[model samples]
Target: MKQQSGFTLIKVMLMSTMASVVVIGALKETVIQERLTGNFQKDMNARLLAEKGIFTAANNLQKIVSDNSSFSVDDLVNQHGLHVGNGEIGDDTVYKARLSKSAEGLLEITSLGQRYYGDANQQLVARFELKPADIKSPFQHAVTGCKGVNLSGSGVVDSYDSSKGPYSETNRDSSGHVNTVIGDSSVTITGNSPIKGDVKASGVIYLKGSSPIIGDVHSNTGVEISGGGGTSYRVEGNVYSGGFFTHRGGEVKGYVRAVGNVEMKWGSKIINANNDPYDIMYGGTGNFPASYHAQESVQLDDGTTRQNVSYSDAYFRKTPEIEPVKVYDPSSPDYDPAKPNKECDPFELPLNMPDVMEQNPERDQDFAVGATQTYMFTPKIGRLMTSQVGIKKAVALDSKKAEIYLFDNLSQSHGISDTTEERVFGMKNFKVYSDGKMTITGGDVIFLVDGDFVLDGNAKLTIKSGSSLTVFTTGKVILGASGQVITEKEGMTSSGIPSLNFFSSYSGRDGFQVKGASDMYATIYAPLTQVKLSGSGQLYGTVRGSIIDSSGGSGVHFDSALKDVNFGSGGGSDEKSQLIFKGWFFEPAKPLPDLETDEGETSNSDSGSTDD
Candidate 1:
């Protein structure tokens, strides 16, 4: 009995030892599970923080697209990142973001989020992208006329990419592509000059003399080249015309295409840039060599057969596929403002000019002393005021102040012809600061003329550096033969300076100007006015009006720099500027090493300390 009792005791001791081991193992497993849960929670919190950073960046980007805001990611958030509250499962949670612009005008953004629970930490990252809405403008072209364009005499048209630097008559631009001349109607090139740009016209294109075109010339109507020496009249690029293309004597280095007849005179030739046979297209029937000169088989407008007809039979065939060039007329109900026009609509002003009434100026300021001297012409009733008078002080006019002249009714009795006495108003010598200096305050200084403005006598409008002048007239702007205007700013002799904007109302005397011997750089926008540049006048920048006429000695240079000028919000539907958003993305999340305790052990705490 004693032996049996001893065996039972041993069994009991062994069983108790096994039970203790199992309990110890269970406790260890619980601790490991808790640590794993803490780590998973921290990682998830970091990812959420990263997502929040992306959201914030998106909002800021939208703001920039809506308005002209700074494109800095740091500006959007505090140091390109924001600290939310405490992490869900960790401490010291924060997310940061950054912005960068690409050469293709793309906006890129990146964000990172991090969380810390004691010594353990986790991180996540993301990225996004954006683009500009509109980039169209009439200014992109060197010269664009709504009506027709006529290049006569020794007139020359060339191009300079201002993106390179200032343009000079001596140094041409580096943009391999030449300046472009687009006329909605006809484009007439005459004289022994040359055009260093592409020419496009919806109407007919008439080329005369030994004029050389460096770029392509395209017309919807016909292209007539009449001159001697095929080499003298050379086209470096292709030539396309919808109607009959009649070449008297010209050398085309590129393809020649015409919807109608292709009449090549004796010296005319066509070749590719490599001096090899090139392509040729003719929609209408015409005389042709038995064997074509094209590198490839000459294709007809029908897209079916090659030009394999005999010269004798190649007379009057028509191709129905070719369409005529559509001309742009503002009067057309389907007119598109985004499209170019041949002439400025008389009823519609240039989109550049702000529609502000001069009679009631938006910004009015009284002239300060030494800035201006007002002269009043208050004629007695029934009496004529006729006199050649003007102010030729050596005083330099202040651009901060305007010289406003008030006059009574400006009109002459219809029945009273001979009586210089019956003329109610007439100033023969109405001049302001003639032969004197004018100071531009870096801001716009307006000259408001209530009656007819005649820059007579030796009246010379001289401008100073960092200044701009604007002449707002309710009447006519007449410049006498002796009158002159010039600028001190180099490369800006006319009113083309950002400070000068000559605005004339449609109601005024048809915007008539007889300017001569003047070196002025200005953007004259008088759609109803007839602007004539005579007597060796050299004008730079853009000019738009009812009729633009220049003499042989006069010249007009279009400064490519004018494209950068903000001529007020553009007119028409397609003129307004805008922006747009592109898309978003998620980058692979980069994990950070887990923070550990001083003893190199992971901290798995139920409650973690928060980073203030």
Candidate 2:
């Protein structure tokens, strides 16, 4: 009986031991499953964080490319990498990003994401391609007024394609558009002059007298047309006004659209291109009244009367921003006033006076006072500096290439053939009394004038064929009565107009003036000054300024070839080029070293991945 009881006790102990082993195995399996699920969740979160890092890095790169034209994607590879944000997200998740250039010459952005607590990590790479952005030419119009424009007298505003030939009636087109960008400014066209192009203004546009606008007229504020003296004032193209449209004694040969009221006075009519009466469309809810004289009615082509109409499609566009002028920076390492490819910005001159004086100290001399002095120049004497040059007698320049810097004003009086008169005037108090026939020949020449430039009384500045002249001034420029700037020679098939260029940095009113019967064949760029064309002076190339005032019988002719000219690298906005996203990919998750410390805590530092 004792042996049997002992056997029962042994069997019970063995069963109890087996039950304990099964329960321990089941608990161990449950713990392993939970740990697997937790690790899977951590891996997904790290991957999502890596994607966020890639997108953020790409966004930053795009902005940098858009804001700076000189910025290149290669700069990123040189700098190794750029950090994205603070690199830390909530719940102990962190990310790191770097931009580099791939072997295919494309931009590649790499990102690493990690969760320190679980020791999970992810990596991704994105690629991008570079493309040129859409850029517009700065000189898209005949005359661009940064402030305002005034077209008075009988001066005609017209256009001609110099790429085709010189100005002729058959070679002309209606592309001579004039505009004023200032919202408070206006474009005033008065007298009997005819504008053979479109007129656009941000504010009001005033058209007075018997002048005719051959193309469309668009004004953001209002349009006023008034005529008298039995003259037929006309606008041959469509008229669009954001405000009221008033016609006193003129004719509109096309449709008229206004956001405000439309008024037509006696003898004023609206017609189509075929001279048939057309309806006026207005969007204003106010009353629009029309008045006519006794023998005149609103007659249509079918001999029927027509009435004005209303429209819901009448809309006004926001004014476009004007293109700013670009100037040179002296502090730049690539600063070269003679080179046209240098980068520049606004309010800075291309040439620095101090640098010029320092480089050509031996070339400094006073103005010579004698009989016609002839100066020959080679590469050794390519640069010269003078103070206040007054040309009385004839002065001849023969050069291969040269640059002349004038510290003060340059004045030229009437020419005199008598040497005795020159000597006598020289003996007297520095008063010039000789002919000012300054002739330039041989090669290209540039002049930098610090003060005013006055050419008057038969002062002739002749630029011979095969040679060009460029003038840069900081003061007023005046071509007075009987003054002539002859660029075109007899029997030349092509015009010499492109060879002469005038650039003024003056910021005052009437900074550039052309008086009397002088004819100018040059392009003028004076963004901060006022360009005035008085008397019968005719300008043949494009002109850009703060204000353009033409109050003479002669006109302005824009050369279409000037549109293809490139001034330099920097101007207006910096969005000249950009990059485009191509594709992206995920890299294999690199094994992260266990960061668990002895205190049963995870380390914050991610030392597994290195920046490249």
Candidate 3:
């Protein structure tokens, strides 16, 4: 038995070694497979969570905007999901925000999001960047929040606290071109290399060399280029023309939406311009194309700053309309706290909500719409269409989830569940609707529309500081016609009429939609801008960046106008509150030809005329 069992020691050792190698290989393969599967699942979950967070943030922002007609990151955070929580769509997983601006006025946002794994115990993280679609945004050069030198040129970025007075240049970089960026603190761009981002704030943005931009440029303000550059070059953002913006002798080859008082600079070889100085957009074109927007009365200050004087107004046009009398009770104190806010503008369409909130017998059973059609409420009014035309019904949703459109705040329990349903939302909460006869019936809807809005005879409209809006005809605001708009907000310095700095954003869909009775009366009690009228639509209100191009049609009818308003120093006169003409203050005619410079100009030789 001993002899049979006894294998040599060397043979036994060799067999053991072979077995160990096989076990290690098999174990490694299994671990690798598990890891791969885990990674894939983690990525999928992260993407879903990120999308959810974005939707949630957008919804909350809408709510803020609808109320004041404006919103910001702070407002969003206050309204939406928490930055940290258990849900997959927590703030850490998703966030809508604004990053710090460079000296050029570009905003950049950066963040990391965590994803949920199949098991409650597993999660992963992903880094991301959100770039805004405007010129001069810091995101292009990786200049975020308050870090780095975001100015145009390259060198040590000079730091100058505006609060501390005049800025001084300390460190000098004599190496090359001195197109340095003025930053928040100590930063620099070696003019040798094209700074990573767009040239911010100052309308004058330029590149010393022929290098094109790597990221989009944002001129939410405007842009000015020296050295003869024009429309043949690449610009990722909108190009605002304040003055004669010639590049370094090149052409612009991208999108440029100019909205200012007048053409800043004259045309050059870079862009084909007609002799008419104001005809900047149609520089070389002989005729003014209907599609071209000739900003006649616009003022392009410095390159980044501008204003469309002709149109400026703000308003909420809160649904459950109002013809503001005196803001008293809850939504502006009123005789009947339960009655709809009389101060709300009528023309401002109400956001669609659950009919349950209104006990009207004629309203739709519920505010639900299929993907095929816009939410139609047949409450005496005809079919209404909102920009948010394509929204799916909650009940009809395939996954039992209500397809919230233009809404925010999905996690904090604001959905229309089968049982615990309450108020639903519209686009980012910015717009809501119910296609029914808009007869004021219910506890007044008191959402705020930020800006200075003008209400015609739907006089219940109330505008406050910096906000501007124009009420058109058609709908009637809730408040009775007081003929006076309440012009005040909670945190305004002096009780002045609407201005620009008040809101982070604004709204004015259609500006005004006046019908037979819905006309803009006047706001003697409050300050106002110029009101223009001519055709079908009335001036309900206006946003900061808007142009009233009613020139092709009839002039907008304005029964009244504002008075003695100072827009700025050495600029243009503010006719009453109308910085620009009430109507379309633009040059619509085609530019005359430049035949004189070309060989096309010649005398007839057959009849003894000079043909030289």
Candidate 4:
């Protein structure tokens, strides 16, 4: 507008430069904001995919309630949008769907999905709450992934016969045999001695006898067992029983697991090896052996239909994660160096040993020839009951050789008593290797031991229930039973080693000892009172005591959360994966009918725990 004056070259250049700078800055800001928005959109979509999949599954489950049809993970993936093949983020991968119990009387169907990059991975999870809303009027939802398999009412057999081929609903021992048409099927039991064959029913199964069981029993829908009356019952499969497996007075063989709760009725005992001599069911997977009682009592979910049921204020979940490591012997070819290339053999003496090493007749070829000093006890064929480890005041160990050492270390026993101390064996010596399998059988034995002994390999040892074994600081002598009739020699001792010390009434006056066990991974299966964990190992049983201790064994550790434990101090001690003790902190044991305790505890005489 000023008309006529031509702009200067310098001004023109400056204006252009400023304009370019401003424009570039604005462009950069816009680009950054756009990128952020796009990322947010992508994240939102993925989240919706996960959540929406769950919602879709919930809606699809309409058919399951209507039909009660058994469903699997594949069915859920295909029918529901959970495993949507058209997922934008790589090929969609879905994990298996498993059914578990919910707080309410419902089933929880869930799935785990994941996507993997070079080193980074993302996991997506979805869950559906399934409740049998209408047991009768089963209807399916519009959701594709949802389906149903109808299972309701009592399971019964119209007629059963093991002898005449078809156990027709004719004349049979009607004592506990229920001959009725449950739901839409007829049920019958043959031979009368408590239905002892393969059974597939829609409803309840009412069989009689004193724990009447011969072979493995399986049920597809559900099973409700009253008293065993002493009959033995073995169930290899899961008891999806709408009711709990209650045994007022019955014993179960094999494993009696359920989709619900595992509990016992009135006066019952769930012992690893005791009482029932001939009652046991075998033939299954894993190292679990035969003749071990598997049933004391188990309840279904809370809402499960049952005649009568009892509940514990606390949940006793005893999980025994056993690392069955063998005792390594370097003398043999199967030697693995603790530290790579550290060639040291314990079983075989060094060639540099003085002439005195070879001439000892008692320790001749048999001891020196094979994998000896630095040997590991590899697992052979054996089965160990992980549920409950029996403890006692007195313990017994079988000698690997004619003469073995004994210590004051804890072992798998019943428990210890107060009035009997000097009459028992105290842990003192060191070189006692029962190969990790120490059986305490003598009556009311006592011990005072030192140091923590680790049991190598899958050592199988049984201990008396009511005996006691203690550990010592300078560890006392490895004393045996009365007049040392038990004949437990002293364990091998190292120059310097730490130990555990206890002189309480349970362990007694003479105290307990830590027997000499070099390549030992000893598992003390008992109602643990006080423990001093050393070395890197695990405790596989229950500890019903005032306090749980993890004082020593820097690298040595163990976990004793197998039995539902209580922590008075609400504390936790974990060193890597070696030791984890879920103790019954000041909590008393559940009052079981078959297993009772002394009144002195409640009355405050021999009361309180180590923590106090």
lDDT of 4 by residue, 19-127 (tens): 9999999999999999887656544443433333333334445544334222333333334322221234444322222233335423343432222321121223333
TM-score of 3: 0.22
Reference-based TM-score, model 2: 0.59
Off by over 4 Å in 4: 1-7, 69-84, 87-128, 133-612
Q: What TM-score would each prediction reach against the true structure?
A: 0.61, 0.59, 0.22, 0.18
Best lDDT among the predictions, by candidate number: 2
lDDT of 3 by residue, 172-279 (tens): 111111111212112222222332234332223444433334233332223444343322443333344332233333343343333332222333122223222232
TM-score top scorer: 1
Candidates ranked, most accurate by TM-score first: 1, 2, 3, 4
lDDT of 1 at 351: 32
Local accuracy by lDDT, each model: 0.49, 0.59, 0.26, 0.27
For model 2, residues 115-143, the per-residue Cα lDDT tens digits are 75439888888898765444333556787
Q: What lDDT is obtained when candidate 4 is compared to the true structure?
A: 0.27
lDDT of 3: 0.26
Question: Residue 148's C-alpha lDDT in candidate 2?
Answer: 78
| RMSD (CA, angstroms), candidate 1 | 13.1
